[model samples]
Structure formats: structure tokens, C-alpha cells
Target chain A: MKMRVHSSCSAAFSARCSRQVAPRAASAQAPPAVQVDDFDFQKYVMATAEKVNVALDAAVPMAYPETVHESIRYSLLAGGKRVRPMLCLASCDMLGGEESVAMPSACAMEMIHTMSLIHDDMPCMDNDSLRRGQPTNHVKYGDDIALLAGDALLAYSFEHIARETKATPEQIVRVIAEVGRAVGSIGLVGGQVVDIKSEGKKVPLETLEWIHVHKTAVLLEASVVTGAIVAGASDDDVERVRQYGRNIGLCFQVVDDILDVTQSSETLGKTAGKDLDSEKSTYPALLGLDESRKIAQRLNEEAKALLEPFDAEKRAPLVGLADYIYSRTN
Target chain B: MKMRVHSSCSAAFSARCSRQVAPRAASAQAPPAVQVDDFDFQKYVMATAEKVNVALDAAVPMAYPETVHESIRYSLLAGGKRVRPMLCLASCDMLGGEESVAMPSACAMEMIHTMSLIHDDMPCMDNDSLRRGQPTNHVKYGDDIALLAGDALLAYSFEHIARETKATPEQIVRVIAEVGRAVGSIGLVGGQVVDIKSEGKKVPLETLEWIHVHKTAVLLEASVVTGAIVAGASDDDVERVRQYGRNIGLCFQVVDDILDVTQSSETLGKTAGKDLDSEKSTYPALLGLDESRKIAQRLNEEAKALLEPFDAEKRAPLVGLADYIYSRTN
Candidate 1:
């Protein structure tokens, strides 16, 4: 793929944050669309991530029973891509909503994501010692505190959205329900259970699809859909956003699986090749690396097509996000 | 105290389900009120518990990902007093709302309570093997699945209430917020953190009160208040229910401490005197047994008084519940 370094920002930063566009030969028959070369995807991701980080920090304070709050703050404040919250904000903005209105729900999405990471890294679960290049929650704080902190964060996610969201009661209720369903049995937890059971077994491709769709895609879908809901998007628009979210959600995981085998641990900030070591099935394992890369490209194209119905400028962040997911090396 | 066993039910059942009343001489200055001689407190408790158990059984099915669902059902369907759900139903009924309207929230309450118990009994936490006369969640399911099950249940609690509740959107939002707060860091998780930290140490009375108030009373308070909110009760009525719940909630824990010291393991359906064994501070430890009993009596009276404004028939279950909390030997 041909990559162009936009000169809108400083040359040094532009070199570090190049936006990669698919080669024109790959989409010869596609409609002429607004060029994404001018969009500063790096600046958009960083700015949204910084806003979410500040909001998260303010949401969970260093309160009494310092250990529990500290444990929560420790993992929550650890840096990440903030892809989910950025998607949320972008979707809301696309639907003509102000950033302030969707900020709580955005923060809530990150809180839930952070909580899953904390619990997933527990001694009884994945048992990882390092996450985001720091000691895992259970490794630093004892398992007991880490467990409570995860529970606290899960509970706080709903409370924060409900209490902090400035949307109408109807909108707030829908957001809560959406976020709740994404985190509940039929979503994250169910996927984790199936994944654990399928370990070391020859799992079918259908089952693998179900696992990733539920565990990862559901929350991403919620993030995008909730942003639209909070902004009072019409039913058609909501459905379009949901489709966009699902395609990219799957694309993100496919790329993640490829990176697990192809990238180094330092670049990933986690244990690379851990999936192969554990014999956990991944897209790259089931399909060849080349095939997985092809699937990701297809998904990115489909996700970007779903955003075509929206105004070009409004959809830039989401469209660029799809490409970002596909082009990420880590 | 004087005891009265209502003969409204069969003699055999009456013998097994006696209702104890405070001696008339104990409250000489109190106004003459509805006679407790006719109210079937045992029948009310049994009937509510049975109904709640059946509802709970129907709420969580043994579906795919059988381990997770079964784990939730195992602890949820296990026979217990179902005091929390009953409090919710009675509170809603008192405000003239149908049981159907409150059933989902009641089930959600049980789910949250069961989740707390499951996580609390994990190996990294309290690490108990027995709960409700059977092996605890971690003992039957592995620690990893148990942890996920707890998370699933907690997530489902909010979802169930939001999706199944028939109340107004405003009321549903309030209930979700209320339940979330009760389960978050400032409530159950917070109390557990402090209790764990203070283990084997001489905690002050104030610290103990804070622990019990946050740990036990908050959920009970949510139970009553949410019920009132769902029924669209006046703000005054909700406040009254909150106060009544708080008083009885403290009474329940105080009596529990007394029973831990006095009852056998078989009678309590779990390990007896475990708190004393762990050197954890309790009401009976901080205050003498006699003094704790006195305090419990005072709390029961205060709780009952809070219910006096409601119609006698409407408040029967709550008043009976307060007395039941006091008189249970187990």
C-alpha cells in the first residue's frame, strides 16, 4: 500500500504519524471519493485519547480506602490507543452532537474496556504479569484488591454514564441498556467462557467467529451505536453506524491476531506470540497470514463504505479509523 | 419477649413457623396499634421466598456456555430467606404497584446479591467452601469461571432491570443508578476493602459502623428505595422507605453477628463462628452480646416506626420483616 505523510503537522511528527492509503490499483472500480490524504488521523486519535484520559482521571478519584481507588486509577490511567472512545466521539459528532454531550458515555466505554483488561489479567484468568508495559493490576495489588477494583469499575461504568451524561432521560436509559448488554453474559463474559473452554482444542472457524464477534465486536458496536443514540440519530443512521462498527471491530481483531505472530513484544506492549505459545486459535493460525491480511483489507473497505452515507467531513475520523486499524503494525 | 404463633395456618406449619412479638410491657408508652396476633409473618416470609425462588429460577436458564449460566443459577436458585427481594416487593406493594412491575428489579437484586457472594467466596477473597449448605461457586466451578460468572451476573443485573422493567424510563434510570451505587466502590466493594484491611486488627466502633452501613445497609436501602421509585411513590414515601431499610439493614447484620457466636454450623447453613475465628470485629465483639441485642432491638423498633405512616395492611410485610430479622435464632 502507498503511504503519504501529510505535511499539515510538523515534518518530524508527520514522519512518525504517516497515514497509509490503499494503492489505487486495489480499488479501480470504486466510486471517486473525497481523498483521506489531507485528514490528520494521528492528531485526531491523540486529541480524543487525551480528552478521554482526563475525563477518566476526574471520574475516578483517589478516595478513602485508598488501595481500591488507587488500583482502579492505576489501570485506568495506563495509556492505550483509546480507539473505542474515539469511535464514540466521532460517531456522535457525525450525527451533529456536541463532544460534551457524549463525553460521559465515551469515558464509560473506556472504563469498561479497562475493567475487562484488569479481570482478564487476573491470577485465575490469563495470569499475565505485564500489561501496557507495566505490572498487571493483580501483580501490583493483590488479587483480592484487583478483583474488587474490577468489580468497582464495572459498577462505576454504569453509574458514571447514568449520573454524568447530560442527555435526555430517554437517551441516557438507552445508553445504559446498550452498554449493559454489551458487557453482560451474552457478550463479553460469554465469549470469554467459550474461549477458555475451546483452548487446546481444535475449534471450528464458526466458533472462533462467535468468540471474537461477541467478546470484541459487541463492545465496539455499542461504542459507535451509543454515540449515535446519545446524539439522537435516526433509526437508519443508527443501523448504518452499527454496521460500520461491526466491520471495523472484526477488522481490528484480525489485524491484532496477525500482529501477535508478526510483531515484537516491545512494539505490542504485551507478550507477542503468546497466542501461538498457548495454542489459542487465531485468524492467522486458522487462515494463513496472507489470507488474514486479505480479510482485514476487505473488512476495512466494507466499514468505510458504510460511512459513505454520512457527510464526508463528519465521517473522516471513522473512515480514517478503519484504515488505522488495518495499517497498525502493533 | 412474648411470642405468638398465628393459628391461621395449619398447626403443624405454625409450630415450625412461629412469630415472636415483643412483650407488651416493653413498650408501655407506645400507641395502641394493629394487633400482631392475626398477621401471619411466617406465611408471608415463606410465600415471598418461594415466589422469588421460582422467579429467579426462570430468570437465569442453563443455556450455552452452560458453566457460566449454571454457576449463576446454582447460587441464585439456592434456597435462602430472599429478604432483599421481599423487601423490594413489599415496598412496591406498599406504594400500590403490582408485583409484576417490581419482579424484574427484585430478580436483579438477587442476582447482584448472589454475585457479591460468589466473588466474596473466591480463593483470593474470603475463600469459603460452603454457602447456603452447598459448595460455594469457586468450589464447584473453577475460580476463573466463578469470577467471570460474577462479572456476568453483575452486568446482567443492570441489563435485566433496564430491559425487563415496565416502569417509566425515568424510574428505570433511577433504579439503575441506585443499584449501581449500592454495588460500586462507595458501597459493597468499598466495605469489603475496609473489612479486609482491618482483619485481625482492633477496629474502632466508628470504622465497624462504616463497614456494615456501606456493606449491608446500602443494598438494602437501594432495595426499598428502588421499589418505591419504580412504583412512582412520592419523594416523601421514598425517603421514609430509605430510613426504614437502613434501620432494619443494620439490625439484620447485628443479629447475624449474634447468631455466628450462638448457632451451630448446621443451623446457619455455613461455617459457624467464622468471624470470631478470623478475629474480625463484629457487633458482639465491639459491644457485649447483651448490648448488641439491645441495639438490635432499638433498630428494629426504629425501623418499625418508620413504617407507621403507611396503611397497616400495606406495611405488614416490612414490619414483620423487621421483627423477623430480630427473632431469628439462626
Candidate 2:
């Protein structure tokens, strides 16, 4: 009975196109292809991300174990979209709170995200040699230092959230636990493990969906959830945003898989088609590229729908983000 | 002037011989060594560590991304003495408090320590093949998973403290900052950085002292200081005990150097002679064997002196710990 409920709600969204289930018209409200140029939300997001990036660079010191500290610095300074943290800051803003109130959480999420990237790009895991248009952390600093730098960043993230943020201790405590849950065995780490194990194997579709949800989606959801918590958003409000984040996170990854096949490494700043090369199961691999794109369009609509109760002025960026996730080619 | 004061203090303590520094005189005047043994203290520490270990084990589950989850569990459950956490637990007992109050702090310290160990044993840092008589985490889990595991553990440490401890929010905030300093550039990571940079070089004694004190002693001192904080001990008292811990931590490392030269891997549970082979400026390398022993002895005396204000019953184990450190051949 529990399994059916679990399969119906959270897992069903990802499993919509499976042969066992037919897609309904209600679930098929394909989001309009909003041109990226029309929304200027990208500019806001990019500007917000740039501020967080600069803040992160200023925050992490250059002084560390010489061999490993350089590696940590290299990875942190390596550029990315900083989407998760920017989303958090935006979420707080949407909840009628100051961005400063969410800055620490923003920085922490970025650090945690960067740490994951360092580990994910190592020779032993994804074994990629590049990130953000440059050599990956292990490639630049060697494996050992890369590993330690990641650990240092992770440690610093918690400390930063707890100390630098203005939230009360009780609130900090809640965010801290959520951060842990986002990355622990049940969060990002849990998802990566399954991804690795399923590589080159014909695994069940549900298992693959689990991997992406726990690994990629949980942290994304956590970003909004943490921001909402800090901004004093109601629990129901937080849950709605969480659901919004979940659909968008998966939609984001589905777009990524589509891009892996469609885009170039130069365009993506990371290995393109590498997932396919590794024989990893992806949305495109399961449902074909056209079907994956359709699923992503559907999920984006669902995500935007979840935000209907939110004030329209506040939710513009979120709705815009759903469009952005599906529209990005790289 | 500050440098001179630091140098004089270090030289004064570093110059003394071990035999002259042993607490034989103090123990003889107070209580017999045999009478001072507290079996219950050991049992209490063990019990507390066990409870934390159980909580940690249950905390990390093999869920989605089973491999990464398992990888995190592999490193976390890998056995060690749980000494850092024990220090927090023991300090609480010394201040007449229940282990429950200190348990979260204890667990947090252990997690930070474990994260360091995980990184330290990586191929880039210490490059150690073994830890706690087992293959290093990276060796068992691969560098990527090992890196991620350390990150998850480090971040989760603060999470555990913030969520689980009964201390005030202000106190939890303070503790998080303290732990960050101990783990960051000013503390363990900084020391490690210097140590790595100084490898095979003729570094000044002062710089070497900074490396050990920051890298190793800071966290060790933090364990004791945090325990006192958890018990609401006065700042002055905490400072005094911190000095005590600092002295002992340095002595402990000096003793460790001596053992590395004198003991076999079979007895020490780690490969010995790495310092000698690596040309790391250990105590034995800097002071010669006879002088290093004397230095250890003197440091031991200074450590015990700080505990004079505490009751003999409360301080016996701490003092005993000093003796046990030097007594160990391995």
C-alpha cells in the first residue's frame, strides 16, 4: 500500500511515459517555449550568481595545506551558473525577506555544490578531466588534494551557515539538518552511488529515476526549502516550493541529458555526450530524445503550476526558471 | 615581541628532559598511580562513543544511489579509537555533567576528525595506505566516493551539533565557529598546508611548531575546550584547560614521532619510518632522541600543572592520559 502511494505521487511524475501508464491531457499541458531573450530573468539570475561567486571567492582563504589548499581554491573559483544558491537567494526574496538574510545559506549551498563537483569529476568516479571550461579539480591539484579540499569546503559550509547567517539557533538547527539530509546517504551521495552502480547496465527505470531525484533533485529542493525556512515561509508554502523544485530539478537534468547528445563540449563547458559514451542510462536513453523533451516540457508546466498560489509578482522568476531549464541548449 | 614570547615559551618547554617532567612527584604526593586508575571513566567514555557510533550508523542509510550511500557508510564505520569525541565526553564528566549534554559535540568532533583523516590519507596529502590498521578510505571506496564521503561527514558534523545538542542557540553558533576555525586555514587545514609545504625542507623550529599546533593540536584542544563550554565552564577555566590540552597535544605528537622511529608496524598498527623517510622534522629529528624524551616529560608536567585547581578525582584520567601517551612505545 505504501509502495503504491510512493509510486503514484513522487515517482509517478518521472514515470509518466512508461508503457504501463498513459499520459492524460491534464498532465500534458506542455509549457509554451518562452524565448530566453524575452524574460531577462536570466540576467537577474546571472547577476545574483555572480555576486555569490564573488562572495565565495572572498570567503575561502588562500592559506591552507599548500598542496591541497590550491586544489580547493581552484575548484571553488572555477566558474559555474551557481543556480542552486541563486535560487535560494531568489526564493528568500520572493518570500518578502531581505537577500542578506539568505546569503550565508546561499554561500553554503554553493560550497556544498562545488564540493560535489570536485568529487564527481575525480578520476575514480566520473573521471572527467574538465569542468567549467577548464581542467577538473583532480586534474589540476591531483586526487589527494582535491579530495581534502572538498572536505574542507564541506566542513566550512556548515560552519558558515551556522555562524554567518542571522537566523536564530533553532532555525539554524533546522537548516543544518536539512543540509545534512540533502547530501548524506539519502541525499546527493545516495543518488551518485546508484548512478555509478547502474552504469553500463540495463537497470529498471524506477531505479534510474530514484538516482536523479535523490542525487540531483534533493539538493535543488533543499535550496528553496532552506531559503523559505529562513524567510519564515509557512510549512505548506515551503512544501509547495519544494514540489516546484522537485519537478524543475528533474526537468533540469532531462534537459542536461538532451544537451549531452545535442550540444558540444565547448558549448556546455563540460564533457558532452559523455553520459552516452559511458553507457549511463539517462532520460533520453529511456524515452528517446523527443520523448524526454516532451517529459521535460510537462514537468516544467507542473512546476510552474505548483507556484500558482504564490503572489504572481514574486513568482515571475520561478516561472521564468522553469522556462530557462527547458530552453537551455547547454 | 609576540614572536619572542612564543619562542621563549616553546624553547623553555622544549628543552627539558622527559624523566624530569613526569608527574611522579605530584602523583606520589596526591594518590598512588594504581589507585588513580578509573575503570568507570574508560567505560563511560566507551559507552558514550558507542552511543554516538550507533546514532551515526543509523543516521547514514543505504538508500538511493546505494553505492555512494554505502561508500559514505564504509568510511564512517571504519574503526578508530574515537579519541576526540571521548575527550569531549571526559571533559563533561570532569565538570560534573551528564554525557548527554556533550554527546552531540563529541560526535561532531569525531566527524571533523574523521573527515581530516579521510583527506590526510588521500594520495595527495599524507598518501598513507592505511589508517586504523585498515586500508585507507580512498583505497576502499575510490577517490571520488572517498572525497564525497569526507565532505558529507564534515558538513553533517555541524548539522548533528546544531540539531542534537541542548545548548543555547548562541552556544551552538559559537561552537560552530570554533569548530570551523579548528578545521580551517587557521587550524588543522593550515597546519597541514604548512606541513606539506615544509616537507623535505629545513624549516625553522617555530614554523614547525605552528604546523603541529595548528594542524593537530587545535582540534585536540577544541575537543577539551568545547566539552568545558558545553558544561558552562567560565572562559578563564576553559583557557586554562585549553593550555593544558595544547601542551598535551604537542607532547602526544612528539611521543608519536618517537614511536614512529622506535616501533614496528605490527605493534603500531601503521607503517612506521614514514617521517624518517619523508624527512619530516619531527621532535626526534629536531631535538635528538634523548632531548625529545626530556621535552615530552617537561610538557607532561606543564600539562598536569594546569589541572591543579580541579579535584584529584576529576583530573586523574587526564593526568593518566599524559603518562599513557609517553608510555606507549608504539
Error of 2 at B187 (Å): 2.7
Candidate 1's C-alpha lDDT?
0.83
Q: In candidate 2, what are the lDDT values of residues B93-206, reduced to their tens digit?
A: 787767788888888888778878877887767878887688888888776667667776776777778778887777777777778778876677777767877889878878
Query: What is the DockQ score of candidate 2, to 2 decimals?
Result: 0.46
lDDT of 1 by residue, A1-330 (tens): 221223343332222223443432335655433355576766776778899999989999899889899999999999877888989999999999999899988988888999999999998999999898899999999999999999999999998888888889889888888888888778889888988888887698889878887788888899999999999999999999998888888888888899899889897788789888898988989988999888888887788877776776778888777777777776
True contacts kept of 2: 0.62
How far residue A83's Cα lies from its native spot in candidate 1, in Å, is: 1.4
Q: Which ten residues in a row have the lowest lDDT in candidate 1 chain B?
A: B9-18
> What's model 2's TM-score?
0.86
Write the residue-wise lDDT of candidate 1 on B144-252 in tens digits. Answer: 9999999999988888887888999889888988999999998889999998998998899989988888889888888999889999999999999999988888887
